[model samples]
Each structure stands twice: as C-alpha cells, then as structure tokens.
Target chain A: MKQEIQVKCSKGNLALIRDFVNRWLDEQEVKGVLANQIVLAIDEACSNCMIHHHNCDGRSKIEVGLNYEGETIYVEIKDSGKAFPIDQYKPQAINDIIRKRNKGGMGIYLINQIMDEIEIEQQNDHFIYKFAKHLG
Target chain B: MEIKQEKQNSYISLAPIGDLDANSSLEMDECIQDWLEKGESNFHIDGQELKYISSAGIGVFISHLDEIRARGGKIIFSHLSASVFDVFKLLGLTEIVTIVKEGAEIAPHF
Candidate 1:
C-alpha cells in the first residue's frame, strides 16, 4: 500500500506531518522501536525540506510519500527548491560541527544515521530524499 | 516544549520537555540567556522526558557554551531519551557536555 501528502513550508505543517506519519504507521501495523525510528527519520527529512531547503518561503511545498511492501517501509521527501548540491555535501564530524555551532547541515547527517538506507537525487528544481528500512 | 524552573541556592534547573525543534528554540534561548544575564549560570537540563531535539535547538546550546564556561558555570544534561541521546552523540556534544544518566547524579557535580 502507498500513501502521500503535501505540506506547506510553515510551522503549522509540522503537526500535519506528524499526524500523517503516525496514522500511516498505525495502519501499517508498524510498532515499537521500528515505528519510532521511521517516525523520527520521516520527521527529520520533512522538517529539513520545510525549514532549510525552502526556508518557509510559502512558494514551496514538501511532498511526502510512503510505501509498504510487506517487508519494509519506504519514504520519499520531494522538495521544489533549487537543486541541493548533494555531491559537495559532506557529513561534518559531529564534534567539529558542534564546536562551530553550525545548524543547517546536520539534517542530512541525522537522516542518514537514523534510516537504514538513504538516497538523494536532484531532478530539475526538485531535490528528492528517499529512505528505506526493513521491518523484521 | 514545556519549561519548568527549579531554583536551589544559586543554581537554576531548567527542565524542557517534548521536542525542542527550531520554532520553540528561540524562546528557550532567550530564557537561558535571561538567566545567564542574572548571574545564574549553573544549569541542569533535565531531559528525561525530552523526546527529540533538532540542530536548531542544539545551536542554542552551543551559542551559550562559551559564555557559561567563561562564567565558570556548566550546563549539564541528564536522563535523555535514547533517540535524543543519539542526536546528541551524532552532534559530538557527548564529549563537551556533562551527561548524567539520572537526576541524582547531577547533585554531586553541583
């Protein structure tokens, strides 16, 4: 089964993200630690798109899609912002980044750490972040 | 986020519960800065109930780290949820900040 949602880049939309994920997770019968992991990963990815990618411009919206294929759950977050330079992006060492007090780059790092697999691609003006994890 | 204050002697314990994301972090930063300006520096952030925190929230802590250290005060975190702890660990804050597993552990340091 698959589900999809589009959220604006406003603070109010965060609750909608949470609600959509929680409802989908419940319906999929995903529970316990696995469910929590998915929720956190999805939250981080969606929040990154809303806050960092679009900067709450109201001109952009985040599209979140979820797919369940019996064995695993897949999530994709699509943003209509300018193409993010994923090639030059490096995950900063946690200590170094913290010491410098940088806030913007940690989203991708956290998403990578939390999700089992993550893939990033830029198509035209959209940046796509796809993540998948097996539920066992 | 919910903030509750407890004062003992010269130390102030600021307990913030729930997700400390970008939107809520500004108020938190102001609250901490206000306390620092008043010369209350010894802080224990009771995070036992705090479920999640984003980089923006962590930035607020990092921004005040130097000021707190300069004043010979420290901000300690305790009882972090596993997921929150992971975020802190990923940010490499585990080494710089004093993290306690229990609220009681905070007493000995202060």
Candidate 2:
C-alpha cells in the first residue's frame, strides 16, 4: 500500500506531519519502537527540507510519500525549493559532537541511524529524499 | 502539550508531557526563559512523561546550556524513557549534560 502526506514548510506544521506518518505506520502494523524511529527519521528529513532548501520560510510546500512493499517500508520526502546540496557532507563522530555541544548535526545523524538506506535525487523541479527500512 | 512546573528550594523541575517536537520545543524554551528571568538557575527536565523528542527539542537544551552554566547553574534531565534516552545517548548529550538515572534525585545532579 502507498500513501502520501503533505504539509507547509513551516516548523509549526511538523507536528501534523509526524502524526500523519505515525498513524500510517501504525496501520501497517509496524512495531512501536521501529515505528517511532521511522517517525523521527521522517521528521528530520522534512526539517532539512524546510530549513536548508526552503530557507525555513514556511511558505513553500513539502510532500511525503509512504509505501509498504513486502518486508520493506519506503518513505520519500520531496521539496520544490532549491536543490539539496549534499556534497562534502559527512557525519561527525558522536564524541566530537558531544565535545562541541553541536545542536545542528543531530537531525541528519538520527536519520542515518534509524533508516536503513537513503537515496537522494532531483527530478523536474523537486528534490527528493528517499528512506527505506525493513521490518523485523 | 502539558508542562508541569515544580519549584523546589534548590532546583526547579519542568516536565514536558507528550511529544517534544519543533513546536513544543519553542514552548519549552519560553517556559525555561521565564524561569531564568526569575533568577531560577538550577533546572531539571523530568523526561519520564516525554515519549519522544526531535532534534529541535534537543536544540532547545543546547541553546540554553551555556547561559545556565555561565551563572554556575545547571540544567539536568532524569527518568527519560528508553526511546528518548536513546536519542540523548545517540547524540552523546549524556556526556556534556547531566543525566540522572537509577532513581536518583535531581538535586544531586546539580
């Protein structure tokens, strides 16, 4: 089954996005811990879109797509703003972040830890972030 | 979201109930800022009721840590749920931030 959820680029709308993804995952009978992890990952993805690509304007729009096929769950987040610049991106060590008390890197870190495979692409006028997870 | 504030002699505890996402993170900051203005230094976040927190929520704590420390004050956390604790652990926040566990009181953390 496939479902799509859409929200404005505002941080104010993040709660609604989290709820929508959670409810959809719950219906797919995803376990609680795994479901919560995915919810976090999805939220981080949208946040990156809103903050980095759209300049956190909240005026632009973001869309998320959820699909369940066999034992895998796929989530895709699309933003129509500027293309995502992922070059030269590398996750820092956990100890380094702690020592520096960095606030910004945790979102991408959490997404990497929670999601199994992530693929980024650009098509037409939109940039897409796709996340895949496997059920236990 | 519901936030319960407990004022004690040595410390003030602010427990945020429900998901501490981007929206509630702002609310949490406002409440903490109010306490800071009132000359409340020691703060402990009772995380037992907080089932979830996003990166934005974590940012709130980071944004306030230095100010609290500059005044010889402390902002601590306690009784985090497993999932919430995992985020703290993952970010290595437990290293720089004081996290009270094993049923310990918040006062000793500060």
Candidate 3:
C-alpha cells in the first residue's frame, strides 16, 4: 500500500504528519513498538526539515510519501528547502550531552537510531529524505 | 492531548496522554516554567499514558534541568512507555533523568 501527505512547514503542523504516517503503519500491521519508532523518525525528519531546511518559514511545504511492500516500509520526506549535510552529520557525545543536558542536537541522532537506513538526495528543486525499516 | 497536573506529596505530578511532539512541547515547557515560578519543585511526570515524545518535547526537560537544579529541585519520570523509554535510554537520559519502574523509589533527580 502507498500513501502521501503534504503539510505546511510549521512546527504546529507536525502532528498531522505524525498521525498520517502512524495510521499508514497501523494499516500495514507493523508492530506497535516498531510503529512508534517509525513515527518518531518521521516526525524528527519533518521537524528537521521545517526547523533547519526551511528555517521555520511556515509558508514552505513538506511532502511525505509512504509505501509498504512485504516486510519493508519506506518513507520519503521531501521539501523545497536547503539540503542537509548528510555526510557531515555526527551525533554529539552522549556523556557530554547528558552532562550539559542539551536537547537541540539529539533529533538527528535519534532518527538514525530508530530508522534502519536513510538516504538523502537533492532532486530538482527539492530535498528528499528516504528512510526505510524492515519488520519481522 | 493534555498533561494532567496534580500535587503528589513533595512532587508536582504531571501525566500526559497521547503524543508529545512539537505542538505540545512548548506547552510542556510553559507548564513546568509556571510551576517553577510558583515555587513548585520536585517534578514528576507520570508517563503511563505518554505513548510518544519527540526531541521537541524532551527538549523542555533538558532546557529546564539547570534552572531546576539551581532551585534545589528534582525531576523524575514514572511508567514510561517501552518505546518512549527506549528513546530516553538510547540518549543516555536514564543516567541524567530519574526513571522509576513499578515499586521503585520515585526519588528526586538533581
């Protein structure tokens, strides 16, 4: 099955993105734990796109696509915004983060941990983030 | 979704139902800040119904840790959802944030 959704690049609108993905996952019979993880990953990706790529400019748009084939689920979050530096992405040190108690730098790290694989590519005038998960 | 509040002993207990994402993160921050300003400390978020939390929601706790510490306050979470707790565990937040399971002491995290 496949589905897609478009949302305004506003933080307040992230729930719609999350709820859409979540309903799709539920229909695919993805396990609850895994589904929750996928939901967070999708949420974080869109959030990153809105906050970083679009610079919190709510006028832009974020398009999300979801597809499930057998035991694999694929999600693509696309936006017409600045491309992210995927190669240069690095998670902050956990100890330092805990000591300093900072939260700003953990979203990408959490997304990486939750999603099995991710690929970022700029196509035409939009940046597409592809994240995949394999269900057992 | 709303976060229910109560006064439990020395802790200001909060219970959130449904997901805690971007839209509600600010509300969480503001709620805690309001309590802090009102001389309420020993924060305890009852996570039984808290199914999900993104960075935006967790950021509120992290941002206020310093201020709460300075006030000799503590923040603790109880009965976190397995997936939600996994995120916290993955981030090593269990070390910094007090998370109590059933029958565990709901102690202060300072």
Interface root-mean-square deviation of model 3 in angstroms is 2.0
> Mind giving the per-residue lDDT tens digits that candidate 3 earns over A43-129?
888888888877778788999999987788898888885678653579877656545866578888888887777898887887888
User: What do the candidate models score in CA lDDT, each in turn?
Assistant: 0.75, 0.82, 0.82
How far off is model 3, as Cα RMSD? 2.4
Query: Could you give the fnat of all candidates in order?
Result: 0.33, 0.44, 0.64
Residue B44 C-alpha lDDT in model 1:
85
Error of 2 at B27 (Å): 2.0
**Alpha-carbon deviation at A49 in model 1, angstroms:** 2.0
- What is residue B18's positional error in candidate 2, in angstroms? 2.2
Task: Compose the digit string of candidate 2's lDDT tens values, residues A33-135.
Answer: 6787898898888888887777778678999999999899998888885555433257776545445655567788788778888888878888788889988
Q: DockQ for model 2?
A: 0.48
Error of 3 at B63 (Å): 1.9
lDDT of 2 by residue, B1-110 (tens): 89999998899999999988866787988898899999988998999789789988888788777778788999888888877887877677777788888588667666
User: Top DockQ: which candidate number?
Assistant: 3
- Candidate 3 reference-contact recovery: 0.64
> Which candidate leads the pack in TM-score?
3
Between candidates 1 and 2, the lDDT winner: 2
Error of 2 at A42 (Å): 0.4
